[model samples]
Target chain A: MYDDRKYTEENMPKTGILLEVENTELKDINFGLVTAARDTGANEVLAFTTEELGTEAQNDLARYGVSQLIRLRTDSADITSSPDNCAAACVQAAREYGLEYCLGLATAFGRDIFARMAALLDVELAADVLQIDFKAKTAVKSHFSGKTMATVSLQETPGLLTVRPNAISPVEQPATLESSVFQADIQSQAKVAVKEIKTSDDRKMDLTEAPIIITGGRPIGKPENYAMLQECADVLGGAVGASRAAVDAGYAPHSMQVGQTGKTVSPNLYLACGVSGAVQHFAGMKTSKVIVGINKDKDAPIFEKCDYGIVGDMFEVVPALTKALQQEKQG
Target chain B: MQIYVCLKHVPDTAANITLKGQADYEAGAVKFVANPYDEYAVEEAVQLVEKDGSGEVVLVTLGPSEAVTTLRSSLAMGATRGLLVKTDEKFCDSKTTARALHAAILQDGSPDLIFTGKVAVDTEGSQTPYRLARLFDLPVANEVSALAINDGSAVAERELGAGNREVLEMKTPCVIGTTKGLNEPRYPKFPDIMKAKKKEIKELALADLDPALDPRPNLGKLEPVPERSGATMMEGSVEESVAQLIRTLKEGKML
Candidate 1:
């Protein structure tokens, strides 16, 4: 635990990053969040985890300037069973650690808990921010389908922020670490009855956190045809997405949608296959660093917006792209 | 089935937007509507009451006075009435938004369930429903694509992304943050629209909720995201294009 008594400097606020677990292992996205929570050398980073990290994981966090590992738990209830339960645990940690700022990824699970924590603490919350100014207690986030960037200034102590995944790359700065467990005390009454979590069969990576994304649009035509993009996405170490038209046509589910109404992504590389690149669709992936558009129509709007374009049928290009990427990997 | 569906008046998602200055988007001539996701929540609640044959589905919102116009659209879809917590400020913080709605709901007494859209379209906060759930001490589920209320509990199938669903069980008097695919919202008929305009819309001030409220978050500059330059088109066959794409990926260290 960071002793606030030892260093009461006004500039050095206590910062905490909520670590996430995927398939029972630490998620890579936490490294960027931890690096950000370090406040560019302004904060002593604290990593809050539900379960105790192994020596190797602790070492990994230490390299990113995480000085302390706090294993949040409750003696009265299980935190992992439900989001509210996890939130309650985090709330107790915020108070216990005297956290001035708390950060987490803006993924689905992160959104569930941080909002709960904000309400429980009666503090202002900022979700899915793209950039943070820790000293000012402010963040810059996109609004109105990523068309505008709004900087929100939070006033409350322990200001909560759920950062967009991959918004920042991980930076290494080694620090000695202290590991501790915080047992939260709370009432025994359970509000939510958390049941089974049905995991996906083919899609293992979360779209928002995926470094690369390959999306299918209207011309993909069939639900089964998404497999072609999936093959390409796999070779690229990425995830698959669908435009609003594809999802609306029932060729894909709303969960896979990437558009004005769907999930906004900021992947490093975005491949738009057969997507017409409507304003709504472009709004979602606008922040991507590099975009490649593949469409049969040479005049597709995506061609004008993307960094690279190929006028070809996705059916022919996607499979060939997948094979090429695979061979590049082997060679 | 006493249900409350929280609503937000927002600019249409597909509307062209221009900013006046910091945190201010020029609202002039922009077609405002009931938030798209909130429409799904209102739809679910109305369908539940319609199926039960006897119940009230109240619509609650916190925004400017003009928000009632948006609220009436939900009323046309068959809500019992509307509660408008008026705020002149266009970009009110979520904390203030949630607290006001919590207070306003208790005015009519606690209902059996509280429903909200998973996200507000303009802000895309995705926080109100969860914050309200915490303030009300209720179990909440966000991004819910499918929901069934039965025997004092809800069996909600929440979308967990990447084609997975979480089947959760929350007891009655809980909160549900509904999203797209939850249900198809009904368009109000001409007769229903006329009837909705006549429906009661009770108004309240922000101060009425809490006399000495906490300081709210403020939004700074609203600037447009810079546009991307035009693409570098690749010519020749599929194999050639694929090769060029691979070469670019390798050069950029993206492979």
Candidate 2:
């Protein structure tokens, strides 16, 4: 059902990826974005960044088939602090490079910039898209919190797409990397200026980016019981999450809640402890490579959805699993 | 000062959303509620107006006549009045919707501020506020978790994911798309609900607004997500299960 024809270099579409940077380092999510762009059968994949690309960033992006790295710079305004200015610069770059498609990860920053770019270019934007077919100028996105999926086609040129993070897996296709700097001469008309950025003091990995995640449900009687899951999470280098029921019960904050109304996570391994396997919670983590459910009820819905199931009290199963992993590490 | 807050009626978050056909949903069993994120915007607008002790919070929506129910709910929560841009179109893209809203706002006299949810729960398109901002040539701050308004300027904080936030300052006459954690929305009292029924709801048609606007980004096909099946149920003690899981993960080089 998918198009398998390969495009020759002469007629290939040029795809530009808006690279994200955090703490002067490139985010690993960009590699996946680069791969997604290349998967569109683009002849040339370009990485656009407001930050200075070091050797490591260049090496990493090149491994994902990014052929060109363009540093978008402007003396008129601080692109990092002004989203309008940043988007203006990106639009200028896209125009100058004759880009047919511009892709970005659908994080807060990407959503902000791409919205502005779409407006400035007077083009249509597909936000939080799951799949894109560049040749057809079409994309598929989830509607109603993922209950329904819609395929939308952009008739306008320079199709702008913001892909949900982790929606696409990264693939390695080494390319010869060439770098250049583009200084956009656009004037900034931004009324909003970012004055400060505050990072949370808690150093735990973000649930969305964690390799492994252990989530608790309503069965977690009290907030203190989360400590047991935290122990297992620490040993596995994962993050601790809670179901919507747990959050509604005031056992955890919304930031740590995983469900249709909360954060959507795609991890390598998801351990659902005492969860009833409500569709709401399952929708958020169904993309996990492996789902393991621990519940005392043999008929719990989670068991049917999980790769591995254990019919036991979470109070008994969680601690035993933590201890076993700890001993295994020590041995 | 005047504030315009855009609202959308969406299916309840817990409701089971079923597809009726390729491009529509079965609304028979689903209950519609005010978009949760938009409630934050309405609450923020009400708080800002109440803080100033003078001003009006006008609710606006672009949908069918049934959307008036959503506007009434917002009015019950303390909005001054509402404007419903009634459209017969089954679906309107963000850009077209923004243009219609822009025309309506201009017809009502440009307000000092505009508020909308960061994204609609139904469509999940987080573009209306930004598109409106651009069409009106106004500055905007989206996904604002915290907000403060002063004489002619405002300061807002946007969550940047991963527990980071950026503090931003923008002038009035700008658009702000509110996110969660901005403020708790208050439930309307019985008396207010009764009064909201009588409040004025001015309905306008798309043709009544700027006729130049046309919907773009046409929808092609819609299909239900395929079901995921085939999960193996482990049969063993807790220790045995953990051991087997670990061994399998190790063999696959996933751990």
Candidate 3:
């Protein structure tokens, strides 16, 4: 057990954040993870990355209180191709640094690597946590799809946790940065290899990572109607989403759907256009910082749950909103 | 060929979950259903076996006896039989759960393929299938949106973030975690539901598998998510509402 009084300013717990990269750039969500690590206050934050950490990336991470950046290297195999190798490399780094806590985002890659880490280390993993208290070795996580929250206590050493993206507000805490590299000894061959990665023609950001999203509902009569929402999304530097009803009606694909059965998104702003706001859809995005519902039906369930409600026909409201945003940008 | 589909009985996504105490819930009235993602796995398993014309789909779950309902539902959807690893423990960490599942699978005999939901909705522990893969030394794919099986091998496609898809091929006796967009799960017909009542549901105690593990992460407190209040209704013409929204976004510095 850790003594709370022993954590002085000079001797604090060390937190290792598993950084994620997308398209050769550091993922924006890692900033929030760094901030959450710092908020624990008992830890000196360091970042570990498997991806190449250029000078610019190190500088970016330093601004978020990362005092050191350790890049894991493999001599034999590409770590990115195999999650087992990646987890092995991470475990090596954690052991080398004597890290007391390991943190990561609860995304596809994080889920893959951390599970392996938990198995290898024989430690408990608190997956997709919403809040954490390092001193108490406890975390709060949502259960039953956000309907309830449970506080969990870690019974082992070197706590392992993966937090939901955008759950913590990012705060800038600049620190002097240092960098190092460690090569891990990985012996296991990759059982499953990523043979090919096919990118879709849609170049817009994904709804899960978008800072803002505009979602259409069943009232979107046809597929082309999504163009309007796309235009508005473009103005806001956001992405276009759809309710399950709209996807079922062929107005959009399942990838664009945002509901319980679809992607769960936590954006700064979510504009629901013409959605009746079923509980299933709300469960996916209830954690969004702000929800704005626009619907013709005044009694729609979405109105009661959203931070702002506009009772109006979406056909008229969305176009006007887009025009206003465009003019605002130009002016 | 033999196929196994792992199922978990979770609180219905629509259930109004209420906390009963610091580490418990008022689950007496809550209804449990086959996790929606696991339903996709069940459907895919049935389709694969039916296509082969010489295989059976087995449904397995680790939960209390009431979880038999979940297995029966899968049986109704065309599974050949069911297995329930009965346990009275209220909570088990993902690793322990995986150990139990691994023991159960070994006891029942290894299959050519295994299917599970990518993540359970209640715990959202997306670790079971991968842990099982490691335990059995089998290749595994997760969040698989498409799958094709041939003689002794299988091809799977997993959806990556940012609208990308990764195609992978692995040998047989592999594990696959099914996600949405895999297939439309069939609704069980009345006749099938009636037949499911008579389907064999083998029960085993925790001691039967005798998994050597301990629950690590333990639950501490349970609480309802704090509700968001103070919604401002925008009551105005179309142009006015749009203007107000723009102004509000600017004030929030979100524009």
User: Which tens-of-lDDT digit does each residue in A1-331 have in candidate 2?
Assistant: 5444543664678889999887778987787789889974455898999889789989999998998999999998778888999999999999999998899988878999999999888788898887887767789987777667789996776889998777787888988899999999988777689989888887677787677899999999899989999999999989999998998898987778887767777777899998998877876887677888888998888877777777889998888889988998999
Pairs of residues clashing in candidate 3? B22-B221, B22-B222
> Whose DockQ is greatest here?
1
Task: Compute each candidate's TM-score over C-alphas.
Answer: 0.94, 0.93, 0.95
Task: Evaluate candidate 2 by giving its C-alpha RMSD to the native, one decimal.
Answer: 3.4
DockQ of each: 0.72, 0.65, 0.71
Please list the C-alpha lDDT of all candidates, in the order they appear.
0.86, 0.85, 0.84
Which candidate ranks first by lDDT, i.e. highest? 1
Worst 10 residues of 2 chain B by lDDT: B226-235
Q: What is the TM-score of chain B alone in each candidate?
A: 0.94, 0.93, 0.95
Which CAPRI level is candidate 3?
medium
Tens-digit per-residue lDDT, A40-108, candidate 1: 777888889888678888999999999889888787887877677788788888888898888989987
Off by over 4 Å in 1: A1-12, B207-217
Q: Model 2, stretches more than 4 Å misplaced?
A: A1-7, A222-224, A326-331, B248-254
Between candidates 1 and 2, the one scoring higher on lDDT is 1
